[model samples]
Each structure stands twice: as C-alpha cells, then as structure tokens.
Target chain A: MKRRTRKAFISLIIAIAAFAILAIELYPIAITVINGFRRDIVILSGQPFKLSQLTLRSYQMVLKNIGFQLGMKNSIIIGLLSTGISVLIGAMASYGIARFRFSWRNGLAYSFLVFRMLPQISLVIALYLMFSYVGIRDTIGGITLAHTSFNVPYVIWLLLPFFTAVDKAYEEAAMVDGCNRYGVFFRIFLPIVAPGLVVAAVFAFLNSWNEFLYALILTGVNAKTAPIAINGLLGGETLTWGQACAAGTLMLVPVFFFTLGMQKFLIRGITAGGVKG
Target chain B: MSSRKPDTDGVSVSLIKGKARHRAPFLFLLPALLVVFAVLIFPIVFSFFVSGFNWPLSEGAGTRKFVGLGNYLALSVDPEFWNSLKLQLGFIFIAIPIELLFGFAAALLLNREFFGARLVRSLLLLPVFFLPILSGMTWRFMLQPRYGPLNALLLKLGAPEITWLGRPVTAYAAIIVQDIWRMWPFMFMLLYAGLTSIPQELNEAAEIDGAGFWLKLRSITIPMLTPTIMTAVLLRIIDALRVFSEVYVMTEGGPGSSTTLFSLYTHRQAFGYQKVGMASAMAIFLLCISIAFALTLVRKNMSLDSLEEKAGGG
Candidate 1:
C-alpha cells in the first residue's frame, strides 16, 4: 500500500510537469488560433477580451485578400512540382548508389550530404544571380527549380537507406522472372520502398512549402508564397495582427493534418538524417 | 545455395561484374546528376567567379570590373561582419544547450506509457510544422509590448510590461526563446527515437542489479546515446548558423543590428546594399564554415559497410 502510494505520487508529479510543459509549448499556437477569431481592436488593446467577442472578420479578410490567394496557389504549385521532381530524381540516384558498385559512389553520396548542409543564403545568392541572368528570376519556374536543387540532396539522403535495405533476392528473383533492371526497379523496388518514398515526399513538400529565404530572394510578386504574404501584413500601412494570425492558421492547416497523420513517418524522417549525418 | 540469403559482399561483387556489361546504374543516375550539376554546381562555380569582381546589382552584370580578393578583404576588416559572426555563434552556443536540456526532459517525460500520450506527442510537434516566418510573426504578436499576451500576463503578475522586441537584449532573447520553442520538439523527437532504440534488455538488466533511474541513465542510456546526442547537437549547430527567416521576420536583425546573424548579414550585404560581389564572398565564407562542419560529421560517422548494414538491419 505504501509502495502504491509512492508510485501514484511520482506519477502525479510527472503528470503535472507534462501538463505545464504542454501548456507552455502550445501557448503560441493557442494564441494564434484564438487571436484569429478575435477582433483586431481587442487583440491590440492588450487586455483580456470576452470569448463572446470572437468573430470571423479576420478569416473573411484573409480569404478576400488577393495576395494570400495568389501566394497560396504559388506555394502549392511550387511544393508539388519540387517534391515530385526531387523524389523521382533522388530515388533514382539513391538506388544507384545503393545497388551498384561504381567509382566516386561514396564521393557522390558525401557530396549530397554536404550539399544538404549548404546554407540557403549561400546557394540562393548564387541562384538569384544565375536565375536573373537566365531571365527566370521571380518566376514560379525559377523558384521551383531552386527548391528542387536543395530538395534533391535531402530526398537522396532520406531515401538512401530505404534503397540500400532491400534484399538481393528481390532483384535476382525479378531478373529470373525476365524483368529488366528498369522493370525490377520500377515494379519491385519501388513498391517495397513505397512507404519510405511517401515520407520523403511529404518532407520534401514541407521543406518547399515552408521555405522562406529562397522565396524571399528568388521570388517577387508573381511567385510569392504564403509566408511572404503573411509577412507583408506586418509591413503594410495598418498592421493586421488578426489577419496575419488567420493566414498563419490557414497556412498551418496542411502541416497540422500531416503532423497528426504522419506522426511516425515524420519522426523517422527527422531522425534518419541525423543518425547517419 | 540459391535458396540461402546471399552475402552482401558476394552480391556487391556480382553487381559490379554485371555493371561492367550494362549501363543501367549510370543511366539511372544521369538525370539527377545533370540537374544537380546545372542547378547546384554551376551556381557555386559562378559565385566564386563573381566574388572576385566589383559586382553590384545596380551596375548591370555586363559592366562589372574585376577587383580580385577585394570583397573578401573588406569582409575580413568589416566590424559589422565580426558582430554578426559573434551574434551567430552566441545564438548557437546559447540556444542549442537549452534546447538539448529541455528537449531531453520532454523526451524523458513522454517516453513512458501514459493515457493521451500519443495525442500529446502529436501536439508537441505542432511548432516544428509551423512556417518559420509565421513562427516569427506569431512570436512577434505574442511579444508585442502593447498588445502581446505575454506582457499582459506579466502585468497581471505585477511586473513591468516588457518591450520584448524593442530593445537589443530582449530582442535577441526573444529570438532565442522563439528558437527554443520552435526547435525543442526536434531534439525531443531525435532523443526520443534514440531512447526507444536503446535495447530494452540493457535497462532491464541494469534494473535487476538494483540500479536507480539516474544511475541507469548514466551508465546504460547516455553512453549508448552519445552518437545520437552528438549528431543532434551538430545538426542544430549547422541549422542555427544558417538561421535567417525567423530572425528576419522577428527583428529583421534590428534594434540596430544586434540580432543580425550570419545569413541575415549576408542577405543585407547582397540585397539591402546591392553588394553582390561582397555577398558572394560572404556566402563562400559561410559555405566553407558549413563544409567544415559537414566534413566533421561525415568523417566521424561514415563507414560505408556499417551504413549499408545498418539500413539492412532496420
């Protein structure tokens, strides 16, 4: 009975600590969500407002804002294009590095690792100049290309292990069954690593979706993304904190869902790179 | 023999022999290599060339004059450059340790079986998914002295309303706090995975010997987790060095350049001052620093056989 009580007390302490940490950790998000519905006047007043004062005014404004609409569209377009291209290219390259013996193989793998670590500022500076010279600067194509460059290395690194882990029997069996190498890769290897590919794709999308500095430099009005659009709210003549919050909340919609749904994959993807870094 | 699991070395040799007859691997790698060369390699090479010139955005690309090593020399002597370097190092040194500690604690807390633990874990990752720019904005809203909730709560506690982002020190702290808030989940996730990957039998055996929690953690958990911890810290350090969007959105390295970090400083040099040459030089410098870190990571951890086997085992 005494031991049971001690266990209960310890668990109680742990529960309390978890609650406090969760509250602190989730406070900024909570405020963002709450302020999205509150009136700007109430938000700016810096005082507690009644729950009854909540309204859809901020969401209404954000939805009506043309910049938000355009930015959201461009972000989605860039995210999908970049993710698709990178996943395909990265998967192919990773498979080669995994399955084949070639000179410069390890060298290429290390290059990707190093490339993955290259600062966005460093690469984007050069990209901005190069894109401008090529007359693609500030266009969606330009930004998409830039996103793809960085995403490829990350996708390769993320998917390398998945490719390497497939058993040699699968390939030999496929070969015996009259499957060409490409056929084996396309049909067998892909299906086996489909789950890993999904994780890599999701991460690649997220990186492109939430990307800021590259977008900030490589894009202007036409290719601006949601984050940049929301940031513009701050620089406007009237600071619309409520609307910014609403936009931020909207931007988080995909991330929120992805986080909940892909919890395991997200954790795995994050750790995989670090473990092998 | 065909029914048995083929050894990796034998498979590798067969693949190598097969590779001599077919160009499949090369063909598979060609597109990606081409794209990488065009998009990544070319720009890096171009940047190096441009860094030697007196290139300015205002002066069209055609009219730039060569001033070999000038921009690098300027950066070496620039006080602002040193200040930004100091700030970047400070941010890394200060933020990473706090993040490591808090994240480790959070991981420990959540590592156990508890009701609603899965839901809590999912919720904890919310910050990691937040767009960094929006994170900066959200924190900016919360740190607003006039209208922020934090100051309101402080005032309720009979404390002075702090202009969180108005002053240099507080502004810097505000960014650090925001970073800790945004990043602790990452460390938690990594460490949690590390914690889980630790062999359960080891801990059970230690417990059988009557070791306490701290002792078990010290002896069985931490020593085993050293690689993960090192990897996590180094990854965070590299990321902290590259930080821009959050700081840009929050302080814009403002309150008189106090929060100006490496990336932001490079950005200011390039776009703000239109010093393309100088910014290119700075970028190269940053790249070299990053390469040093990357080399350390690769040299310390990489063994091709181990990497391959680890993947196969998983």
Candidate 2:
C-alpha cells in the first residue's frame, strides 16, 4: 500500500510537470495572438492576460504598411531562390562525396562541416564589403547569394548521409544501360533522395526566412527582410503592441505550420546533424 | 560468364574509365566549391587581410592605411571587449547547465508512455521555430515592469513590482531566462533522442538486480548518454557565444553594457562606430575562441568514443 501510494505520488508529479510544460510553451504564443487582435493598447498594457474584444485593426494596419509588404516580398524571394539553389548544389556535392572516392574527399567534407559551424558574424563584414564593391550589396540577389553560401554547406551535410544510404546497384544498373553519369544522377539518384531533398529545402527556406543579421547588415532600404522590418516596428518611438504582435504573428505563420507538418523529418535532421558532427 | 566480353572493346572501356575516374568527382564538386569559396573562404581570407588595416566605411578602401598588429594590441587592453568576453562565458556557463538539467528532467518525464505525448512533444518544439527576433520582442514586451504579465502576476501575489529590464541584474537575468526558454527545448529534444536510443536491456537488467530508479539512471542511463550530451553541449556553447538577435532586439547590449555579447559588440564596432578594422580584429578573436572550443570537443569526442567502446566490450 505504501509503495502504491509512492507510485501514485510520483505519477501525479509527472502529470503536473507535463501540464506546466504545456502551459509555458503555449502562453507566449497565445498571448501574442491575443494581443494582435486587441485594438486598445491601454487595455493590453493593463491586463495582458485578460481577454478583450477582438478586432482586425492591428492586422489591417500592418498589412497597409508598404515596408512590411516589400519586406514580405523580399523575404519570400530570397528564401525560395536560396533554398532552390542550395538544394541543387548540395545534392550534387553530396553525391560526389558519397559515391566517388577521391583523395581529398574526407578533407573537403570536414572543411564543409567547419564552415557550417563557423559563426556568421565572423564572415559578415568581409561579405558586406565584397558585395558592396561588386555592386550587389543591397539587392535581393545579393542577399539570396549570401543565404545560399551559409545554407549549401548545411544542405550538403544533411543530404550526404541520405545519399550514402541509397543503394549503389541502382546507379550501377542505370549506368550500364547507356545512361551518362549526369543522367543517372538526375533520373535515379535524385528521385531516390527526393524526401531528403524536401527536408533540406524546407530547412533552408526557414533558415533564410528567419535570418536577421545578414539582412540587417547586407541590405538597406532595397531588400529588408521581414525580421528586420518587424524589428524596426519595435525600435519606433511609440510602442504599438498590437501592430507589432500582428506582424510577429504573420511572420510565424509559415514556419509554425511547416514545422508541424514536417516534425518527423525535422527532428531526425537535427538529431543526425548533432550526432554525426 | 557465358558471354565473354569482346577484346576489341578494351580501348573504348579504358578510355571511358579513365575519363570518368579523372573528371567526374571534380565536375560534381565544382559548383558547390565555387559558391563556398566565393561566399565563405574568400571572406575569411579577406577578413584576415583587412584586420591589419585602419579601415572605415566612410573612407574608401583605397584610402585605407595599414596598422600592423594595432587593432589586436588595442583589443588586449580594451575593457569593453574583455567585459563582453566575460559576459559570453558567463552566459554559456550559467545558461547551458540549467538548460541541460531542465531539459533532462523534462525528457525523463516525457520518456514514459503517457496521454498526448505526441502533442506535448510537438508543442514543446514551438519556441525553437519562432524567429529569434520575434521571440525576443515578445519576451521584452511580456517583461515590462508596469504592464507585463509577469509583473502583474507578482503584484497579485503581494510582491513589489520590480522593473524587470530596467536594472542591470534583472536585465541580465531576463536575457538568460529568455535564452533558456528559447533553447531548452532543443536540448530536451536532443537528450530525449539520446534517452530513447539507449538499449532497454541494460535498464531491465539493472532493475532485475534490484536497482532503484536513481541507481539505474546513474549507472545505465548517463554513461550511455555522454556522446549526445557532449554534442549538445558543444553545439549550444558555440551558439551561445555568438548570440546576437535576441540580445540585440531585447537589450541592444544596454542597461549600461551589462549584456553586450561578443557578436553584438563586434556589430557595434563595425557598424555603430564604423571601426571596421577593430571589429575585424574582434571577429578574429571570436574565431579563435570558437576554434579552440571545437578542437577540445573533437579531442574529447575521440576519447569518449574509445571509452564507450571499452565499456561496451567489457
């Protein structure tokens, strides 16, 4: 009976802890969404947790801002372009590293890992100067290129194991049947690794979309991304909580859903990177 | 084996084999190597070159003058730079252990079969997906002294309303808390991965031997989790050292420079003060620190692998 009571007490503790974890995780998101719908800043300030009358004024205000619209456009373009280019290049490189045994293969692979792990700040200044000199500093193309540089290595790393896991017999048979190396890669290998490519593309898109430092330093008025624009709202003299929260909610929408849909692959990807590195 | 290969095809086969062996790998690697070189390697080399000069953005690159070792020497005595380094160390040392502890506890709790486990795990990962800037801004608003929900809760509990982000201590604490909240989920996921990967037989055997929960955890669980723990710790330390967006959006390294992280300081020097050379030097210093940590991690990982092999084999 004593042991049963002890077991019951422990289970109770675990349940309570689990509930608290849920509350803590959901609180900020709930508050952000709630505050976005609120119109009166005074009420928001006074009773942040209280439910007030919901309205679309904040969203309307944010959507009406030209900078927010431009930022959204630039963010989407950069994210898509970078993810596409990074996945294409990363796939080829990972195929080479996985299938071909070259003298410098291990060295090249390690270097890519090191590059991926390096902090962006260490390299941003040089990139800024180089881009400026080349006359693409504030352009959408420039930011996309910068994002690709950081992301391709990550994509390559993530895709390498996936490619290595694929059977070589498929490629060998395709090659034996009069297909060239490129054709085999495009026809058989690419289709085989499509799931990994999807995961890589999703991660690359999210990384580029959420990047702030490069966008802040590399771009001016021309190609400011959503994070930077949202940050600008916060930096304004007046605290427009409703509008800011609305923008925040908008920025989070794609990523929140993407994460939920691809939770399995994302978890596996993260663990693979951590464990293998 | 029934059909012998044609001897006349030897020339064509050798030629094709030679071409494939010699060129395919390089061809495959060319595009990625070019991008990495242009965007990553070139910048690193250029940063090193520019670190020796007294360069400013206002002054064109042609007008820059060389100052050999000047920026490095200047940093040796710069109190602000030193303080930022200290703060980064403090942030990593304090926040990482707490994250690991809390994450481990959470992982342990959720490792058991339970109702809504999938839902809870997914919910826990939400913070990891939030944009760092947005997370920082939301936390900044929520920590407001007068109107923030936290202070409001405190007021209801009969405690005095404390200015959360206005004071140095509280401001630093707020940054740490924000970081812990944003990052503990990552550690939890990784540790939970580690926990789930452990062979159940070891724990079962321990249980058969009359081992209690604590004994099983210490003897069977933690030893097996060392590799995952090391990887998680290394990644977190490297990440924490380079923290910027959260601190930038929340504190801007304020409360009298109490929360100036290394990256934020480099940014201020380069952009705010327009001291490009000085900032480059700081960036190099940050690079050296990262390299040292990474090397230590590699060496430790090697040793740990050998140790684990022995433990398992014996």
Candidate 3:
C-alpha cells in the first residue's frame, strides 16, 4: 500500500509537469491570438481580457494599409520564385549525390552543408555590395536570387535521405525496360520521392517567406517583406500594439494551417535539416 | 590484398553495368553547382578579397583602396568587436544548456504512450513555425512596461512592476527569455526524436535487472542519445553565435551596448557606419567560427563510408 501510494504521487507530479510545459509553450501564442481581436484602447488599457472589449478594428486597419499590402505581395512573389528554383536545382543535386559515385561527390555534399551552416549576415554584406554594382539591388529579382542561394543548399540536404533510400531495383528495372537515363530519373525516381519533394518545397517556401536579413539589406522600398512591414509598426514613439498583433496573426494564418496539415512531413523535415543549422 | 582485389573487382563490374561510362552524374550536378558557385561561393571569395581593402559603401566602387590586412588589424584592437564576440559566446554558454535541459525534461516526460501525446507533439511544433520577427514583436508587446499583460499579472499578484527591457541586465535577460521561448521547441523536437529512436529492448533489459529510472537513464538512454545531444548542441551554438533578428527586434542591442551580438555589431558597421570593409572582416571571422563548428560536427558524427559510399563499399 505504501508503494502504491508512492507510485500514484509520482504519476501526479509527472502530470503536473506536463501541464506546466504545455501552458508555457502555448501562452504567448494564445495571448497573441486573443489580443488580435481586442480593441487597441482595450489592449493598451490592460483590459485585453474583458469580453466586451473585443473588436475587429485592428484587422481592418492592417488589411487597409498600403505598405503592408505591398509587403505581402512582394513576400508571396519572392517565396514562390525562390522555392521553385531551389526545389528544381536541389532535387537534381540530391539525385546526383545519392545515386552516383564520383571523385568530387563527398566534397560537394559537405560543401553544401557548410554553405547551409553559414550565417546569412556573412553572405549578405558581400551580396549587398555585389548586387548594387550589378544594378539588381532592391528588385524582386535581386531578393529572389538571394533567397535561392540559401534555400537550394537547404532543400538539397533535406531531400538527400529521401533520394538515397530509393531502391536500386527501381532504377535498374527502368533501364532494362528501355527507359533512357533521363526517362528513368523523370518517371521512376521522381515519382518515388514525390512526398519528400513536396515537403522540401513547402519548407523552402517558408524559409524564403520568413527570411529577414537579406530582405532588409538587399531591398529598400520595393521589396520589403511582411516581417519587415510588421516590424515597421513597432518603431517610433507610439506603439500600435493591437495592429501589430493583428498583423502577426494574419501572417500566421497560413502557417497555422500548414502545421496542422503537414505535421508528419514537417517533423521529418525539421529533424533532417534543423540539426545542420 | 587478396580480399581487396575481390572487392575492387566486384565494384568495377557493377560500375560498368550501372552507367556504361555515360556522363549522367556530371550533367545532373551541373545546374546546382553553377548556381551555388555563382551565388554563394563567388560572393564568399569576393568578400574575403574585399576585406583587404578600405571600401566604403557611400563612396562608389572606384574609390576603394587596397589596405591588405589593415581592417583585420584594426578589428584585432577594436573593443566593440571583442565585446560583441564575447557577448555572443556568453549567450551561447548560458542559453544553450538551459534549452537542452528544458527540452530533455519535456522529451522524457512525453516519451510514453498517452492519450494526448499526438496533440501535444503537434502543438509543440507551433512555436517553431512562428516567424522569428513575429516572435520578437510578441515578446516585446508582452513585456511592455505599463500596459503589458505580464505587468498586469504582476500587479494583481501584488509584486512590483519591473521595466523588463529598460535597463541593461533586464534588457539582456529579456533577449535570453525570448530566445529560450522560440528555440526550446527545436531542442525538444530533436531530443524527442532521439528518445524515440532509443531501442526499447535495452530499457526493458535494464528494467528486468531491477534498474530504476535514473540508473537506466544514466547508462542506457544517455549513452545512446549522445550523438543527437552533440548535434543539437553544436547546431544551436553556431546559430546563437550569429544571432541578429531577435536581438535586433527586441533590444536593438541596447539601453547601452549590453546586448550587441556578433551579427548585430557587424550589421551596424556595414549599414549604420557604411564601413563595408570592416564589416567584411567581421563576416570572415564569423565564417571561420561557423566552419570550425561544422567541421567538428561532420568529423565527429559521420563515418567515412557514410560520407561517400562506393559500389564496392556498399
């Protein structure tokens, strides 16, 4: 009976610990979501929780702001362009490294990993000077190239295991059946790794969308991203707490859905790529 | 020599059958190498060269004068550069262990079969997807002096309201807290994956011998999880060494220079002062640290075969 009681007490402690961990993890997000719906006056007045003070005014203001709208448009354009280029190039490179034996194979793979580990600041300084000389600074093309530089290496590493795990039988059989090398890669190998391709594409888009330093340095007026736009609200004398929260929530809307739908793939991708840098 | 002959013979036969000496791999790897070379490699090489000059951004390209190691020499004596590097190192030492501890505890707790395990797992990932900029702003809003929710809770509890980001120590503390909040989940996810990958039979064998939780953890769980733990720590340390956005968003390295991290100081030099050459020198320094960490990780973690598997090796 004494032993049984001790076990129960330990189980109770574990339960409480789990509850506290969850609470700490979720509280700031919960608060942000809730405050997004409240009036600015209510939020600033410390009455953010009062039920009657809820309003949609903050959302309206954020949606109607011209600079925020342009920022979102630019973010979408850059995100798609960069993700497309990164995924295509990354898939090819991952396939090459995974399937073939070459003298430079190991050297190439490790260098890409090194590039992925590099701090964006280190690259951004030179990119800033280089882009200005080339006349691509502050353009969508300039920022897209900047995003692709990091994203390609990331996508390659994320997809490496997927390609490596493909069975050799598939490739051999395809070749025997009169499929050319290109046809085998396009038809057989590509289909087998489609799920990983999707995962890599989504993550590449998210990375580009959430990128800040490159956008901050490379673009001035035309290509400011959503993160930069929201950060702009926090500057100067007056703090627009409500609008900032609302804009933040708006930015998170798609990511929230992506998290729920792609939870399995996201877990796999993060483990593979997150450990590198 | 006799055994190696057979292995090489088998590899040569398979290689002959596999591609018939076609240039497929080279063609496949061409585009990516081109892009990576032009975009990343070239800039890095250029940055190294530029660091040897006195190039100011405002003066246009023609005004650059060669100063061969002058900027690096200046950086050697620059107090701010050392201070920023020291602050970043201090941050890595303090923050990473706390994140590892929190993540390890949470992973251990949630490793079993339970009702809300799936839900808890997915929810843990929510914060990881949050934009760092948004994470920074949300914390800034929460820790606002008078009207912030944290202070409101403190007032109700009858504790004195503290200005969280107004002073040097608290400003630095706020940066740490926000970092832990945003990053602890990453550690949790990595450690949790490591926990699940631990062979169940080992634990069962330990239990059968009448070992307790702590003993099993010390002997079985920890030894098996060491590689994951090392990877997580090294990755987090290198990342923290160049942290920019959170500090930029939260404190902007300030009340004073209390929180001027490496990347932020480098950024201030390049943009705020237009000293592109000096900033390039700093960039080169950060690159060296990152490469050192990465090399250690790769050398420690990956075997030679894992790095490159030949047909014979396979």
Scoring only the A-chain of each prediction against the true A-chain gives TM-scores of 0.96, 0.94, 0.92
Worst 10 residues of 1 chain A by lDDT: A268-277
Which of the numbered candidates is closest to the native, going by highest TM-score?
1
Candidate 1 CAPRI classification by DockQ: medium
Task: Indicate the TM-score of model 2.
Answer: 0.92
What's the distance in Å from true for residue A198, model 2? 0.5
Which of the predicted structures, 1 or 3, would earn the higher lDDT when compared with the native? 1
Model 1, B44-75: lDDT tens digits are: 89889889988888765446889999999999
Runs off by more than 4 Å, candidate 2: A1-13, B1-20, B60-63, B295-314
What TM-score does candidate 1 get on C-alpha atoms?
Answer: 0.94
The list of candidate 1 runs beyond 4 A from truth reads A48-50, B1-21, B60-63, B311-314
List, residue by residue over A1-277, the lDDT tens digit for candidate 1: 9998998787777777777778888888888888899998888888744455899999999999999999999999999999999999999988887887665677777787778888888888889988888999999999999999888988888887677777777887778788888888899899999988998999899899889998999899899988889889887778898899898889888887777888767765654454652
Off by more than 4 A, model 3: A1-13, A271-277, B1-17, B60-63, B303-314
Question: What are the candidates' interface root-mean-square deviations?
Answer: 6.1, 9.2, 5.3
Better of 2 and 3 by lDDT: 2
The residue-by-residue lDDT of candidate 2 on A163-246, one tens digit each, is 766766687777778888899889988999998999898888998998999999999999999888898888888888888889
The TM-score values for the models, in the order shown, are 0.94, 0.92, 0.93
Best by DockQ: 1
The digit string of per-residue lDDT tens for model 3 on A1-277 reads: 9998997787777766676778778888887888888877778886435656679998999899887898899999999999999999999888887777666666677677778888989989999988999999999999999999988888888888677666677888888788877788889999999998998998888888878889889998898888888888888678787788898898888788877888777755654544432
lDDT per model, in order? 0.84, 0.82, 0.82
Q: What's the alpha carbon RMSD for model 3? A: 3.6
Best by lDDT: 1
